[model samples]
Target: MTKRTLYLFGSAAPPVFDIARVIEEAQARGWDVCLGLTPAAAEWLADGLDGLAALTGHPVRSRYKRPGEPDVWPTADAILVAPATFNTVNAWALGLTDRFVVGVVAEGIGKNIPIAAMPCVNAAYVRHRAFERSVQELREMGVTVLYGEGGFVPNQPGRREPYPWDRALDAVDGLAPAAE
Candidate 1:
């Protein structure tokens, strides 16, 4: 069987979350993982960019490619936005494609690609009215949002809770076949 391609999009959250573990888990589950980062996330992980690229055998992308530039990565069968922040979620819901990560997500939705977003915002941010609406909008668009009690519950301010990376992976695994 051909391996499924998974695009993993990460945002700047707690610096302690180990993204390598997510990659390893995906690989073990028979997925070919590609890493995409929000600008802040890329900067936070700048020191390990090369190693991550080497691990995935693809360039870690944070910016839009120049005109006529050949796309370097394979088309994704699934997309996971782990550690998604409040800003990213709201922007994505509002159809803002200003950044590479959000652009891919917006396009992925248009293409009917399966997407799982695991948000890591704090309780304070979760209380924002936009957050609820954004999650609902994304769900209406067929994106699987891993939130609420069983998924990613908002943590207390200035406190970090364990992120449920496995649940995000499972959501992708359980997605309906890509729309033809």
Candidate 2:
């Protein structure tokens, strides 16, 4: 059977969130993982881009290619936006596509590709009216917004919580069968 492609999008969050683990686990489950990062996340992970590319056997993408540039990555069977930041969620809800990650996800919704988003925002940020509305909007668009007590619980500002990467993977796993 051909391997399914999973495009994993990330935003700047706690440095402790191990993306390598997420990639490894997805590979173990038979996914060809592709990494996409918001610009800040790309900068934060700049030192490890080479290793990440080697791990996924695909280039780690941050910025959008210029017009006429060839698309390098495989078409995605599903998309997972883990460690999705407050800014990304709001931008996605408002249909902002200045960044590559958000652009792909917004288009993914239109393409009917299964999507799972695990947000990593702080409690204060979650209290913003826009944040809740964004989550609701994404859910209405059929993007699984993994939030609340069982998913990515908002932590106090200035504190880091263990991101539930496994739950994000589970969300994708559940979608994979249907995608096929």
Which candidate number would show the highest lDDT if scored against the true structure? 2
Q: Candidate 1 at 20: error in angstroms?
A: 0.9
lDDT of 2 by residue, 25-118 (tens): 9998889999999999988998999999999999999999999989999899999998899999999999999999999999999999999999
* Candidate 2 error regions (>4 Å): 15-17, 178-180
lDDT of 1: 0.89
What Cα-based lDDT does every candidate model obtain? 0.89, 0.91
lDDT of 1 by residue, 65-123 (tens): 99999999999999999889999999999999999999999999999888999898999
Give the clash count for each candidate: 0, 0
Please give the lDDT score at residue 81 for candidate 2: 94
Using TM-score as the measure, which candidate wins?
2
Error of 1 at 59 (Å): 0.4
* Model 1 weakest lDDT span, ten residues long: 171-180
Question: What's the TM-score of each model vs. the native?
Answer: 0.95, 0.96
